[model samples]
Target: MTSSSRRVVVAINPAASFGLGSEVGPALVTTLRGLGHEVTSLTEPDFAQLLDATRAALREKPDALVVGGGDGMVNLGVTALEGTRIPLGIVPSGTGNDMARGLSIPIGDTEAAITALTAALHRPPRVIDAGRIAFDGGRARFACILAAGFDALVNERANRMRWPRGRSRYTIALLIELARLRPIEYRLTLDGVEHVERALLVAVANNLSFGGGMKVAPDASLDDGLFDVVLVRPLGRLAFLRIYPRVFAGTHVTDSRVVVHRAREVRIEAAGVVAYADGERIAPLPVDIHMQEGSLRVLA
Candidate 1:
């Protein structure tokens, strides 16, 4: 899999890394070029244009596509390279590097992360599953988690606020959302079997973590041909507050109110609820999702 001169396309979210970390994009490009790779670096003003530029670059059939950002950028990669054999590489420089964490790629340290990308390029790309989301307007792919519940609300709220940058924004959002928390009623069909449940949130996870290192589905696997359907039943504010901190260590899954199920295909419905996958707002439920085995090839 190693090449003396590989072509790489790098698309970065300029807003990534809280505005200070955009330098990682140029760092990656420089390092990649130093390694004897032909790199096409693209930095766009917004997500749509970034995705469009990435797609256009991907159309060139480069040796690889390296995106410098968080899981949202990973989502862009899957959307652009869906059904293609091209392997995607990640250079984490965002608020929540859950995707990179799940793949064991270094975070924060640009040098270490780029080193990992370079090493992965020299070996056979790892094959992983992607969750394909089908909602009104369109269908997209998620390489990490797709959640609809209280967490998604927090995501929406956080996106609206501009103060207190970095992970603290999400923390503040979570606190604000928790103050107004109410269990959502959900009708879920897993592998064609249906059930109704009331819970704080329902997360369909392909990777292990989300919302920054919260191991929402600690037992989940990226390559598994199934999704871990996690349901957190209604809890009092006190209980929820206590359990929230445990999610970082992934111990929240063991709580009695928490339940996990496995399915290859899922249909989730909750009136007035919006879903977010890989930290990007997807759509209002109900959305149909299924695990596509080995759908994505990643340079991890």
Candidate 2:
């Protein structure tokens, strides 16, 4: 869409990135408006309210929906605009802007991200695959990783923390969760084939990175129409710690305990495990996750 004809809605979660949204959200509005595009800026008290407001904004059939938060916010946009004509854009204003990292959007640099978004607006939206998780009564859309086991627990713990704000809080929470790490028994069905394994974590990745550039599925692709099923088998605490750092570089996939499978659908069954997608709680285990190619149109 061209600048003059573009009707853009920029939704900001004020609490995201430890309150970075309060500034970045308005800047995005100014930048888009200054470019002569019609822009609507929105901010809400929390994610649920933001989701509702974003859905309302989508009803207007805006040319694009720009989100000013991390992957969780992008996931919210995926929910609101996936399979619709509206293309989603990212501002990467969150603690773990993993979705931006996966999309190669500038992270922690607001100006660069804005510049990228503006440039992308002048071109066609990039079509990419999206993940869906269906449970007993509901389903959710994710643009990045869907994780269960240890890391999901870390996400759970971090969500409950109110002190020591910002990334350090997640560091503290991660160390705490790591101390309690143990093998989890999971029954996984990949593309209809069943397997039972005791693992520390399993990630169904639609993109290459999550957890702030951790290459959980380093070889994964958004247009491949498949999920990279990453499984980390049980390992000793020290060994797991040794491999943990390798995940940042994506070399951990070479470990003997690490197994990568490519599939179009996955069914996960594990006791007492909660699933987290795009760093937000999705639901409990026993969920069916599948991939849909070209399900999302993204601006860069």
Candidate 3:
């Protein structure tokens, strides 16, 4: 869709990023309208409500769909728009705008993002890869990243916190969970190779980062047609403390305790495990993850 002819529908999550959604809604709509695009703003009622609103918005057959919230909101919109021709534009307003940061989108700066969106609308769409998680006849959607074990626990805790927005909340949650966390035994099959280990976390990436700025899979690429599987193997509490800082700098990949592999598909199995995609729980272990090539045409 081109700039002059495109129609836009902006979906707002009024409770995202610790309630910053209410503040960003008006600013984004005003900017898009000022740019002369036909704009409609829809408030997301809840996770379930988002899917229907997204389908309804897509039925309008707009040139582009704009998501005005954080990663979870983006995930909901993407799930609704997957396998369709419409491209997605994101205005990051979540606690951890991981996907937006990975795509180099300007988060929290509505004016700059709107200007960028205007420019992006005129350019050819960029085809990016997205990942899928499947288990027990059920599947959930995500585009950025998926993780299990310690990282998933951290996400669960962060979701429940009532204060301390953004990265600080995540940091506090991680620290709080550190005391009682235990490594779980698991088996990972990547491509065709099989391995078993006690692990702290297993992260599969379609993009580079998660938890705000931590480069859990630093070498991951959105269009590479491959996913980076990173496993943080069992480590003592002191060792975990020593290596945790390196994750933010993305230098932890070189450590022996951390194993990184590239594969087109992977399967993970563990007992009583927690799993998360983007930031939402999809299933337990024994899950299959694979990349969908050229599945999304995103406004970068």
Q: Judging by lDDT against the true structure, name the best candidate.
A: 1
TM agreement with the true structure for every prediction: 0.95, 0.94, 0.91
Off by over 4 Å in 2: 1-3, 16-19, 161-166
lDDT of 1 by residue, 237-297 (tens): 9999999899999999889999999999999999989999998899999899978899899
lDDT of 2 by residue, 1-300 (tens): 463558899988757534555678878889988888898888888888888898888888888999988777888899988668788999988878888887889988899999999999879999999988999789998989999989998878888899887788889998998898899999999999999999999999998888888999999999999999999999988998999999999999989899999999999999988999988888888999988888899999
lDDT rank order: 1, 2, 3
- Top-down TM-score ranking: 1, 2, 3
lDDT of each candidate versus the true structure:
0.90, 0.89, 0.84
Question: Backbone clashes per model, in order?
Answer: 0, 0, 0
On TM-score, the leading prediction is 1
After superposition, candidate 3 runs with Cα above 4 Å error: 1-3, 16-19, 157-173
Error of 2 at 176 (Å): 3.1
Clashing pairs in model 2? none
Better of 1 and 3 by lDDT: 1
lDDT of 3: 0.84
